[model samples]
Target: MNYEKGAKEILENIGGKENIAGMTHCATRLRFNLRDTSKADTAAIEAVDGVVNVINKAGQYQILIGTNVPKLYNQMENLVGPKEAGSKDSANNSGSSQGIIGTIFSAISSIFAPLLPALAGSGILRGLLLLFVQLGWLSETNGTYQILSAASMTVFYFLPVLLAITSARRFGADMFLSALIGAALLHPDYIALMGDIGNGATTSFLGIPAVLMNYNSTVVPIILSILIFSYLYKWLDRVIPETLKLVVLPLISIAVMVPVTIIVIGPLGVYGGEIIASAVNWLIARSSILAGIVVGGGWSVLVSLGIHWAVNPIMINNIATSGIDYIVPFTFACNFATIGTALGVFFKAQDRDIKNFSMTGIVTIALSAIIEPTVFGLLVKNKKLFLSQIIGGAVGGAYLGLTNVYTNAFVFGSVTTFPAFVGDTSANFINAMIGLLISLIVGAMIAYFVTKKEERLVKN
Candidate 1:
């Protein structure tokens, strides 16, 4: 692939690897945190043969390179060294290091990435169980059904444990310790205690009463707890003697942080999460149409720069507290737009390789809910196609908002989310289907008109 030369040219065009503060790659894009956004040569980089698109958002520079992105990412990382981009940015330099909106989206992508495979596997199993029950093959109360349901439900029910482990790794903390902390939150004793307190129960440490909260399938609390643990672990390691450091530090951390987490951090995090959830719900309750438009239209932009992780917690929190979330319907629109746009590119493209890639990407994204492959492969190469998807997404989101569609489960954007609709036989399901259809139609229509055949563009 002449990746060395390509990597050098790419970094040079983007003002060199030195300009990058941190960098990471999703399935199809190289996301860079650059020190000087102005130094980025977007047009020049786009001219590179393998380059698909370049975008700047949330202080990160995103390079779309499609499914073969990992190879390019390896080259870029080799040149730059792996590190968090923009870590050196002074608070003033970045202008508020991912504002409230940025943080929300960042949280969603970060939380979901490592756990997506497990989520997909479990969701598929759940879907199969639902199918069996619907077909009279097994009763919901049957032992076989119960076992199968448990296999699928366990992932979600004990999600905090999984999040804790991944979040700890992301933040560079002790994995086992993080799981222990997550376990503490889900302890039966704690749940029993909270239940006994009912709506009025609160536990106190010293003189401060711990805010009563549950942590199952919760997001913010675990991530936040891991962040604290990361810092604490680092500090403890520095102070403790080298010979005994590993053993002593872990012991102390578990002894102190676990209690502190249970009594202080965990409760506080849960309370804060609830507040945010409440605010979002209030806004949705008041004007779902506006929320839908903003979320659906802007969701791709969020995903592109790895900011979508922040919102997953909010949606999960909504599901835990409110039994449903309208936000997920908007995400469905976003995925459909990507799929439709990719399909459009597949049909319009004259290059055999490009056409094949686009077709494969579209099918994979639609089936697996992984849009990066399509986004970077097809839409990024065709700016008009990208815009088409966004426009289509906005339209679908608006439609869904008007219908007040909601999803009760935390499934990714694909067929897996169908079960979420099954239990809720409201207009929400119909609205979701309509939203998906609208996104597909609008995106395909736009792409059909905007995309140029490879032969036509190259000839011209």
Candidate 2:
């Protein structure tokens, strides 16, 4: 597909590599924090071969490039050279233009973006392992089972350590130093201390009572720690003499920050995450149907706008705290609805390019559950198809809510991982499949009829 040519054309239209402030790529898009977004020629960039669409959202200019984004991203990165560490360009641009909410969302998304693949792979593996156990294909006591289970569980068990690295990069802190803080929170000594505290033991750091909690699998505490740590490290780096900075600064920063984190920041972050998760629980408990409709129907829209990341932490918190989450279950419908939209288009569209595009979207969604190619490449361009997706998702979501379906693991909605939705009762599994089918069928029918009506109108 002449990827090198496509990369060159893309850079040329976005004011060349010099216009870029910082850049990153995700599963389906190239995200650029530009010095001046106005310098970008969106139309010209979209016109480039291999590009599907362009979006300006969450303080970044995004180019949708389907599953081949990494290849394109590599080529583009080579052209732009290496990005500097602690680049505050995004913060500056986000503050002035994106406002507080957008800035926060942008930060959260970028911080977690790099971890998605690891998380998704581990999550799917966990789901599959559980399914195997339940199906009696693998015994829980088997050595192979234990090894596979450990492989699946490692990332989640040491989640704080991973978040520490990503958060440090986001906040312009020392990644290794930040990792030390995360490791400290998950230290075996501290974990044992937590057990002692649970069974009546007291501990203190410097006269103040120390409150320790298990930080493994937690989302917020390490990130908050790193954010504060970054500020403290920068301050220490400035004051310490250059000659002494290497040893004294890290020592002092660790001494001060570790205590402060254990005594204060960690608890605050944990409680904060709990509060957010509890609030979502309250809303869903009050009315699961309404919650389902909103999340299911609106999830694709959120994905389109690139702010879906705001809800991810809440889902993770729900899973960590409660062993189950309902938020991700609804988005399954949104994904299948996208597949339905493609099927409708494939059958009705006479244009060979349109048919091929729809065919590709269907295959992409079926295989990886990635719908951006379908969403940005096709759905957004056709209001009728978009409506089909919304209606289908809403219908399917309502059904799931009515039955109170949920997934035990943090799974990316996909055809391969349907077993993740299995519950204690057979009805739970049955209902999930029913809801998925409802979404698919409804979306396909609506899209088909709507396209037919549009064609008739054109003929008339």
Candidate lDDT (C-alpha), each = 0.72, 0.81
How many clashes does each candidate structure show, in the order listed? 18, 0
User: Mind giving the per-residue lDDT tens digits that candidate 2 earns over 309-419?
Assistant: 899888877776676888888989888888887788778767777778778888878778888878887778778889999989988998888888888777667887786
Candidate 1 per-residue lDDT over residues 292-345, each given as its tens digit: 778887888777665676677677667656656788888988988877877777
Best by lDDT: 2
Query: TM-scores across all candidates?
Result: 0.79, 0.94
The weakest ten consecutive residues by lDDT in model 1 span 85-94
RMSD, one per candidate, in order: 4.5, 2.8
TM-score of 2: 0.94
Off by over 4 Å in 1: 1-23, 34-51, 67-111, 198-200, 204-209, 304-306, 320-323, 341-361, 372-387, 415-417, 426-428, 446-460
